[model samples]
Target: MEKKKVLLLGGAGFIGLNITKFLSENRDYTITVADNFSRGKKDEYLIKLLENPAISMIEGDFTVPATYDQLEKDYDYVYMLASVVGVNNTLEIPHEIIRINTALIYNTLEWLKASFVKKVLFTSTSECYAGTIDAFGYKVPTPETIPLTIEDIGHPRFTYAVTKMLGESGFLNYSRKCGFECTIVRYHNVFGPRMGFKHVIPHLAQRFLANETPFLVYGHDQTRSFCYITDAVEGTVLAMENERSNGEIFHIGTMDEITIEELIREAGNFFGYKGEYENAPTYPGSVARRCPDITKAKNMLQFEPKINWKDGLKLTLGWYKAFFESGKESFEKAFEKPKANV
Candidate 1:
């Protein structure tokens, strides 16, 4: 059989880059990455991927329909992983988050509808299920059946949730109306090597490594279901291959829950740092707890996370050490300052 072709929007980011690497290793897909480098360029990863004859790179914004059109030819799968990410950054620029996320979904769906793409996967976030965990608790995972009504998302952090909800709904609607396969993966806190340090894992890693004083903890009681990059990418690829996933949403994360305090302690342990954590003012739009119900994912796609929290933390710290030692100014910049609103 001929290899399938895949176009990955935002392919230069953490999750996208890992997905590209995983897919390329199979030597069974022609992968083209299109990224605007809004966060920063992954020139090193891009360069390494380019070494593979099957991979191609394109620099463009997902908000542009013409950009999608440029790479729309003869593709079996289209994955839209583009968005203004990081909780702080999203809250600081909610308007851009809403516009870019919505536009990317709309444009990608519109283009795929007109073209012959076989399957399109829209990367949504666990943020969409924000307050659901508050009601459901860790014992009860948030299932996809839960309605995404306004009442379910009654929090300021809902800006990201609401926009992502719109993106998922838009993709499903367009897929149904236009006759294309669509899959939605609501990712939780996916941490791993190459993850932007702006995120919790790498952020903590950097602080621990730097022996920074008064490590900051925002909303110490809040908890989240963390997923490793390998698990996230595996679940996503499985969703793409499983025909049952079309027009469905799956929570791609480990069901285990960890609090901010616990995460800080564990990360400190991973880095062998003994820094004291100080309580910081909670940012706007922060959720108290966010965990997913993976029953649907397991029953439907046989998806189970292989890496537990401790192991994942170790692997991430190793990556952070290498990243720090590489003396890449861009990597260092990732740890400079936290956004006011994350």
Candidate 2:
């Protein structure tokens, strides 16, 4: 059997690196990771991956139109996971997020239309489903079928969600008109090792480790379904391989929901630290509840989250502990002063 050729955009980030590792481990795929080093991994993992004969790396930015010209060569699949990430970062630079994400999708679709790519897997986000709940405070586990009509997006507002919504629409429309295979995975709060402290879990872990006082919580009553990184990688790979996923949108996350308070307490317990919680002023763009109805993923891709919340948090906290102990100057530098806003 011929090895499948894969070009993964943003392949150095948390989720992208995991996907690359999994695909390369099978020894049946030639993987090229194109990243701009915007959020590149440490040399340790990169060197390990480089040792695999099937894996290669390309340093480039996906937002540039010429970047697509470089990727004009044929590949069996293209995974567009590149985006301006971090909620605070997106809020701070909404224009950059919208431009890069939308441009990258358009460039990839154009390249695939002119090339021999078998499929394109575009990673979307659960944020796009914001404001779809009922007035009775009944929050439905959002299915892919829900309408994406919420459009009031901005700084501390709908920055990331709005950009991701546009990216999804661009891919769907291009795939339909240009006859390119496309799959969109709307991910919930995915947590794991190497995830930046911008996320809730890591942010809390860093603050607790630093023994910060009055640990701040935003929208403490809000609920979210946090998916482990491993589960997310499995679902993404399954979506890429499953033919039935073409032109379809699947919610790739754990269906189980937990409140912000419970999530913070779990992380605190993991670190053996007791910290008082104070509800912060609600940001302009925080949701009350977000969960996925992953029936489509399970039925079509045989995807189910294996890591529960407790076990996953334990594993993540363990990694952070080891990272702190390793005395790696870079890791220490990265964790310096927790950014409360993200």
lDDT string for model 1 (1-342, tens) is 898899888888888888899999864888999989886476777789889989998998879887875685668888888887767655467677778878877787778778888888999886665555544543346777765544334444456777788888888888888878899998888888877767777777667777877777766777777898899999999999899998899988988987777887887777776667887765555667677889999999999899998898889888888877788664434655642222
Each model's lDDT: 0.78, 0.78
Worst lDDT run of 10 residues, candidate 1, spans: 148-157
Question: Cα-based RMSD of the predictions, in order?
Answer: 2.7, 2.5
Residue 223 miss distance in model 1 (angstroms): 1.5
Off by over 4 Å in 1: 134-139, 149-157, 214-216, 275-281, 331-333, 336-342
lDDT of 2 by residue, 120-218 (tens): 888998777775653234356888988774545434446677777877888888888776788999888888888765666666766787887787776
TM per prediction: 0.90, 0.91
Report the Cα lDDT for candidate 2: 0.78
Judged by whole-model lDDT over C-alpha atoms, candidate 1 comes out at 0.78
In model 1, pairs of residues that clash are: 88-342
* Model 2 regions lying over 4 Å from their true place: 134-138, 151-156, 329-342
